[model samples]
Target: MKKFWLSLLSIIIPASAVTFEDNDTVVLLGNTVIERAQKYGYLETAINLSARKKKLKFRNLGWSGDTVFGHARSYFGPPKEGFDRLKSDLTELKPNVVIVCYGAVAAYDGQKGLTEFLAGYETLLSMIQSSASPREIVIVSPPPAESLGAPMPDMREHNKRLALYSKAVGKLAQKHKLQFADFFTTLGESKGLTDNGLHFTPEGYQTAAPKLVEALGLSVATGNQLQSEHARKLREATVAKNKLFFFRWRPANETYLRLFRKHEQGNNLKELPMFDPLIADAEKQIEALKKTTLSLK
Candidate 1:
């Protein structure tokens, strides 16, 4: 009976893998643009849809306030920690598709300054493609951050640079024969979807997720009821687990959010407790699972 129950569980649960052959794994990496999706629960929505549609798995590695070039900078001394961590994170995640969204920070200079930014971005993509061997790579340009009605000094100039950056990325995608999602073009048409000229509202993600799906060519109907049912079950379980985790960490999250908001607004920094221990433990478990999944890919 125990063996029977174990077999039943195996049949019910989708295999934990990140490869294209069994499960579709997508990793979204960027700055605040990607953070907005996490905040608005769009990651959950996309994962559920993928599970329902194609039994796909998804992971997000987006960090707020990250620039295309910022990753190569050091917070303390030499040795770029951010970019190193990014490479490790990608290796651990081993996604089937990598969605790169960035440029808000890179376009801050009031000049046509995408030359260095694009070079760094291309390097990052090359590193990932060579190391991970994902089936597809998707480059999504940054959307227009809101103007915030205060007449930003470099808004127009920055936007222009972003447009050029988008074009460059499109060309790179073509050269690599990879798919590109024109988020900058699509999001520029709508001015109401941004919060403060950078982050996205829930509606923005609602518009963008389907576009991402279409770009990946995974939008076809699988017509598999069993897969749909399994995906629904997995989504429910993941959501329930997330809710519990959120409840447990709500206080810390709220405090962090408040401090994070202040930091983003260019306010003076304040002392905060180190989150490395807790975050590191969670990441270890996640990486272990991700590695097992990568082997499948």
Candidate 2:
């Protein structure tokens, strides 16, 4: 049964990785799993490497400690408020592709929350599809925390619970006829990939990001592979652009801006829009620096 599932997964996602088209806007959404991806830059770099002849834009709208119901995004409001916020944000970003990661945090409730998790997951999926109508959706199962030496949270049981959620995610992907990336099986229980067992190290993200690339039927290449003085400059420019966009997408001090106490500091929201010009400037630099195409294999 396990072998059958793995084989099925390869056919749907990793094996037939979705080929990105020209001018595609890829959005990464979820909890800390996706939020932390911005820091490493591996995931974005991998996707960019996969670009054949077109430039792609990426937006990271992940919130730390969020659940399937947008818990973290809620910011002291009801989960539905977070969902609405997500909807509003997506309406603004207008991404044609969305990558979703959730489930790990919810698994904290163990087997007891399985049913609720499944129901909530279904609702979340519908909401996402509705928000970004006609967009391609890829679901990523939360990678299990490493339970090896030094990291002691008795994650063995957590892994067991995660396994169930992973299976459910796979089934949901199949049922919806969408792509699914099983991060759990690929990086879960692996050592050296995570620093604190729960969070991934930079190496871990580089390793894991490839799995998604594979699922998208895309090859991997690193900035180092582009051997040229200009390529180096372009890589740095890309990183700069990404950083600027990150601030625009996920600004700090949400407590006073869009969250619970937003009323107190709502006036400060003006600063958030200022990132737009900086991001545009950085993007122009990246475009000017892309003098050569990467040899993505």
Candidate 3:
């Protein structure tokens, strides 16, 4: 029976048929899972290596503890402001692909949150379509939370709740004809994969990176290649670029610069655009490092 259902899903989901084009800008949007990825660069590094032949640009727009409602992104403003920021960022990036990783935060609300979660996710997709007109959108399910035992709470029941949300996400993807990556099932609960039964450790991100690429129906790099010195350099450059882009969009003191207190230091807002050239330079380094890695491979 399990095998039968799995086969049925393969037919319904089309999980391994999507591809990326040259020069495509891919944006990662979600909560902590996506946000912390930028720090390790494993996810970005894996995708870059997988699509080494293509000149892909990546932007990590993940905000810690964010939701479909853009709650974490709102800062001092109302939740609507956060939603607006998401739209603005997407419009500005003009991404060719947007990979959304949500549900972990929403699943905390359990059954009651499912309906609202699905609704918000649908609205977010609509917003992405209208704002960026992306060539493709991929929705990813949050991986199962781990259970470290002892003082840490066992998340076995929580994993069940996450499974419900993950399945709903897959259905939503089918309805929209968007790509779906079910990490919840593919990367099931594992010991030492996370620090707090939620966020991943450095090694955790590295280990899960390739699984993410595989879920996207893309090629995967060998273990040694991904850990090579050249690959590490590429990841470092990628992280630097993401940091610059982060500051570019979510500048410090946003309240004083562009929000309610802009009257005091709004003129400094002009400095924000200066990060573009720096970001571009970082991209060049990343591109160069990628070529070097490929040459060796």
Candidate 4:
């Protein structure tokens, strides 16, 4: 547990900037913007290159259309059930660093949902602190929605809401003494960044990857590695590992295998952990690919 001391005259201080130490396990959590990164693998590749010499592990737990309340994660259960699932996964992952990005979907609710968004986010931060006790927590604001010309309604008003939510995220980060990454301000509505003015395209993720690395206080000097065939291999391995881990934790047939209907298929529950070695093996391949690239440097 991290300790804090306060003087009668001083305000609460924020934690130091985020850094990826050797052997760190990082968990990326959020909604569509984050979940889509796995498809392109650019974000993780950028981070890996930046931490080339250091052996850092990344587990992306992003759920599409998720919110601070974990609404999207719930299946045949209440929001609390989803919250519990998220808590369990975080505890199991034992991440040294937790990066969270939200507010885009909630921002759609606009001002009426702002209070709930903040409260839910606070609850989430508390759960993360207690569940993982990570050395660092990074709060990332969602990127602004874009307008891709005809058929796409101008999203300037939506961007305003996002800006408001991002501001609140920054304040909350300070209150919790965590690091904040202002992607809303940093990657504001660039042309061709989003496919439908919301989700990022493959090219968009590639462009935004380095920006995310820089925002996390990681170096962008190895950014050129992103263009190499070696980097492609590393990214492919990363995607495979992510697929294995995803099925391990959030299997498509959870209802029959591990939930209320488990009486019929629960016997196969043992198959869940079977992915562990496969995931580990995939990670080893990724590390080997990264090392080969580094040796050439």
- Over 220-244, each residue of candidate 2 has an lDDT whose tens digit, in order, gives 6554554456555665676677788
Candidate 3 displacement at residue 156 in angstroms: 0.5
Tell me the TM-score of model 2. Answer: 0.83
Q: Sort by lDDT, best first: what order?
A: 3, 4, 2, 1
Off by over 4 Å in 3: 1-14
Order of candidate numbers by TM-score, starting with the best? 3, 4, 2, 1
Per-model root-mean-square deviation over C-alphas: 14.3, 3.7, 2.5, 6.5
Task: Give me the displacement of residue 274 in model 2, in angstroms.
Answer: 2.8
Residue-by-residue lDDT tens digits, candidate 4, 84-139: 98999999889999999999999998889999999999999999999999998999
Kindly give the number of clashing pairs for every candidate. 2, 6, 0, 0
For candidate 3, lDDT tens digit of each residue in 67-92?
A: 99897888787879889989999999
Whole-model lDDT, model 3: 0.87
lDDT top scorer:
3
Two-way lDDT contest, 1 vs 4, winner? 4
lDDT of 1 by residue, 1-297 (tens): 235223323322111222244456677778877755655544445434443324444465666788664454333444466677577667866788787877777777534566777788878888888767888777776665556576644355556666666667777777776677666654544556665565567676655655454444444223342124443343344344343333433334432344445455423223222333444454344334333332331
